[model samples]
Target: MGSGDGALNTPRWLRGIWVIPLAFLLVFLALPLVVLIIRTWSGDGWRILANASTWQITALATVQAVLSTVLSLAVGLPIAAVVSRYSFRGRALAQALVTVPFVMPTVVVALAFRSLLGSALPQGFLIVVLAHAYVNLAVVVRIVGSQWSQHDDRYARVAQTLGATPLTVFRTVTLPYLRSSIISSSVVVFIFSFTSLGIIVLLGDSSTRTLESQILRRTSVLLDFPAAAALAVLQLIVICIVIALGAVASRKRGQQKPVRNALLSMPTNRASRTAIHLIAVCSCAIVLLPVFALLIASVRSNSGLTTQWWTSINAIDSGTTRIGSPVASLAQSLQFALITGIVASLVGGCAALAVLAHRWGRFIALFAIIPLGISAATLGLGMLLAFGRPPVDLRASGLLIPLAHSLVAVPLVVAVIAPALRGIDPRAREVAATLGARPTRAFFTAYGPTLRTVMLAAGGLACAVSLGEFGAASFLARTGAPTVPIQIVRLLSRPGEQSYGVAAVMSLILIALTLVLVLVVDRLGRRNGALRPAH
Candidate 1:
């Protein structure tokens, strides 16, 4: 029997996994959006769409996002070429390091940049663009790098042998091969920058306002839900257009033949070797500098280096009335993380299983990724409209934040688990069934090992997402209980040395927690033989 036949033979219990994800998405994702539409329909939301300021902000954000995309590509292309084309000592570490900034909470990144360039550079359009580039560096590297690594280098070698210079060969041959990936990555970076909230909130001025920032302002600062809803809808429409354009651009060319993994070799000439090493070192330094600066800011005070910020983590009054105790925030974050991990894994795992067992699985999988395109601010506002008050008030209930977080995390969980599940051989399950095992037993026998590893990995990732999430949490979190990111933003808003120091300390704690979770996920995946070294 074919793999599809075997998958179809899955037990009744196994086939029912789709229901959980379907129900979860309907209740949490679709319902909230429906509520948002209804609420906006009842208000004067439609008027805001025709406002000149809205379109002006959209135009400016597009310009900023374009600049950020261009800068990220310029910086990331070389790093992607080095890491993907040539494997060297510490290459794995280098690739992992590049990903760190991308996974960091936007609020943390904004704070780190502020602390790193204090008084040296002023926050404005340029600073915001640079920060956007920094955070999105990984998207370019990973997307373009994966394609670059698979690229057949024989074309470049042939060009060289025919009297083409290195630069000429890159321009004529290498660029064409990487064009699709470059476009794909650029589109993703643009969307991120265009809809950005945390960075824009912290670093932007009048010129850098995004539709997302305007939504937050309207909802929180102005209590203008109708206008916020209008902006959110406009932002979503723009994002959809951009994503559609990217999809079309990326698929314009026919698929290239898959190439086998090419063995990495060290550069023969001294000049080439020195350049590669320098790029690698510089990449590491660039990624680490802001983090190191944050670390320094946590301990150093006006007088001198001290443990004051760390010690004051548990105090309610840390020289700020607007901020709460760091200890309380930490506890709140952990609680939310634990809940998000379980909820996301369950929902996402089921979605993956459904994809494996159903004929419509591919469609379902595609549908599940819809959240990835939705901005966090948009999702937050939807959840607020749906569950924040009245008929289905869930604001005081602790489930609201975790539910929002799970929505954010489900896409990631599905991405990680679906691929691993699809790769498992179906024949093992047939063998188990022939040995007289039950359908459930046979299913587990074939896929249990991988499911366990990926679930743990997915759960860990969910925890990390909950810990660093700022946008949705900003909408859902109560004033008394805030997540770490929320607390940090509040501290930064207030002007006090103690507040800054404490925020720094909290940021460091968040960084450490995020890194540990990711590392644990990597290790777990490796142990289960799901993760392997990249070529």
Candidate 2:
């Protein structure tokens, strides 16, 4: 087929499939952004941009985000080198444990850091940076590991065989191969750290205020929605610039040639093998120490490791303080997760499939990823402005959080499902069509089974995302029916050992749910025989 044969080359059944996802992004994604712009304009919120403090915070956040990204890469690169390159014992578990912090709620991670560090590390710049680095460890490991696993170490061997030293070989040969993934992951870590809200709120002093926290303060505390909108715009601008720079840097990495062999066998030498296992152990400790600290904190008290909090889990109610009970908040979170799973899978799945259907698919796909560059604070404040009231109010309807979450999760869903969809053989559909099957039937014959399997997997991921989302939930949740993260934050804000105990317990529960979902998604990806590399 020639380049001119474009959308017409697509199967009839697949054509025009972009409509559903387009409508979704327009109504939910684009609308909210438009609302933000209008709200900022009408309220003269743009004037807040003139505040010198805003720029100071922006400068401060950039520095903090840079340090966080550096630390994450420092910690994650070694673990990625060990886990992804070596075929050693506990390799699978090491990889799984590395991802735990990434999936856990931001607020929950904040609590774990606070509990783990306690009074030893003050709640300010260092603590906040550490928390950001911890949460972003997976971003570095997964992104860089994906490329590192496929990297041809033979290049290094060749260089080493020459006059080059080990460090020189790494700098000359290996680093170039890993540069793209490193830049990509660095951008992600930097954005998360810069736009961070939960960790900054819980573990930060005035020294660590981000535009995200500033927006939250302006909205909920100062009752200045206009000023919040201004901050949101500023945050979005910074994120867009970073994302653009990352894209350019990634593109600038020299052409990546395919390698015949990617994965390496377990090393034979004693020191080398020991080093791999040691790094794996150290990585696991880095990921799990905070979690273990939270666990111990949950049961311990001034009375020396009591179980009163565990026993009182059923009776603990934050409803009197305008939040729901622990059980009720969990239920609320579950419900939101379910809805988010259903909505995001459907919407994002359509977006993925659109790629096979029309040339317009690229635009739709890029549009869907827009949420990635927008901070959660912006998303939440935009939701509030757009649908919290008015001619169209979904505030008390219990659908707002799910809708917002669906928008957030759709990008992930597309990331998971699109590659698998693209991996399917078009010849299967053509074979079915040759057998006199209709267009829809033929399309189904090729894609239906894979779609079903991966949809469930993608849905599980969306559910996991909804389970732990905090920043947006904080803005949109009603006082009476707070989600799990919201309730946890509320509990921690109050005084006493009881509050601390309950919050820790909830954090562990949130951890369990997210990990279970991720585990299931991993299994489904394997079973579907998708593009993901098998262990």
Candidate 3:
């Protein structure tokens, strides 16, 4: 019965792609971390390393990450199952909505959650877990959902026909097929939750502390650079271990062949289809609720749904330095985002190109992703210690926030572009070159258009990242000119109803801005026909 429809084994030329990716891992991924390790392991690093509190925080963070991972999977799996395995109105939009929290600045999400639930739950494990789940919903949905969509429903049907109940069929057949994706997504979510910063700092307490947050505390509040560096290194090592385990688990081995189907036909019956549709809608609503709440808070006030928050943003600080206008923060954030968009896009784009241009390109690409493993606070502090001083004070230049944002975003750009690049057929380049097209011309003729499309998508994504970033900004943003998230955090930290309302207003703007960015990118990707799932 094997008609040879399975994916072929790895090809020779394509095998070399791994080299570039590995090189990237070494350069961008490994080196800063190695530097972090070296700095942390040096003379005074051991003293901080010996502190019992440090280890205690680490243990707490590990538990928090585990809980976050569990909650994320529990909620995200059902959404992934419904959205990926069925077709319905607004399906694409729903899928895109799931990704919103993942990309929003942790601080922004924290503030939104605080506004929505902080009154009831306060800051601790439960609220933190909810926020983590919200942020990571997309990771599970996109990663596992892609695999779920391609699963052969017939296999489950056969299992059911063989005296198996629905639960039995799922447990025996469907679950096994999704094991790799679940493991992969779990690892990613664990890492994100483990390394969390802005959310924990703004919406957490001792119970929800993460190494990433601790690293920041040591570096910024305690001014203990060595200790912070050490924590950063430890975090990196743990992340690498988790990632390695994921890699081993996700390797294709004895897996069933993928059975692609149109999105519309996967559900078993009308009731099942209707159930999936409702799940998709509810999931999307869940994803959008906090954001919509922010929007409502922004507009609605004691004056009975007034635009005072929007209109009085500038005058909110007319005569006092107490709370600078929310509008001012909005402008500052936008400017910083614009700079971050250009800088990160260029650096990340070059890093992506380097992967394609040279044999050692992968190393550079990996180097770019290292920022992901490093805590934002650690990066922010390192940049501060290294450059926020006498001869090299970038803080005054107003470039610090943007620079930090670019560092945070470079990894994402690589993630978005590299996979897309891998999907392009290299044979098209060979064909063009054979037809007398010059090397550059042939390259452009083959991959240029796709590159443009993905770059725009990546750039928009980077901009969104920059706009939402808070951890780094907390370290570098000017005292007077805080970014929106920073301002929101500041307002929330203060005690007043007006402050809370204004912070909500700021959060709403952030939500609108992020949605627009995502929609625009999705539109462009669709127009260029690059919205297909990455392989």
Candidate 3, 339-413: lDDT as tens digits:
888877777777776666655567668777878766677677666755566777878999878878888888887
Work out how many backbone clashes candidate 2 has: 0
Order of the predicted models by TM-score, top scorer first: 1, 2, 3
lDDT (C-alpha, whole model) for all candidates: 0.87, 0.87, 0.76
Candidate 3 weakest ten by summed lDDT: 1-10
Q: Tens digit of lDDT per residue, candidate 1, span 1-535?
A: 1126875558887666677888888888888788778777889998988889989999999999999999999999999988877878988788889989987889999999999986787888998998999999999999998888888878888999999999999998888888898998998899999999999989899999999999999999999998898888889899999988988887766554547676468789999988888888888888999999999999999999989988988884544544568888899999999999999999988888888777666666676778888899889999999889888888888889998999989988888888788788888988999999899899899999899889989899999999999989998888878899999998888888888999999999999999999888878867766442111
Q: Give the C-alpha lDDT of model 1.
A: 0.87
TM per model? Answer: 0.96, 0.96, 0.87
lDDT of 2 by residue, 357-382 (tens): 77788678788878877888899989
Which residue runs does candidate 1 get wrong by more than 4 Å? 1-4, 252-258, 316-323, 531-535
Candidate 3, position 382, lDDT: 61
Candidate 2 error regions (>4 Å): 1-14, 318-321, 531-535
Candidate 1 residue-wise lDDT at 168: 97
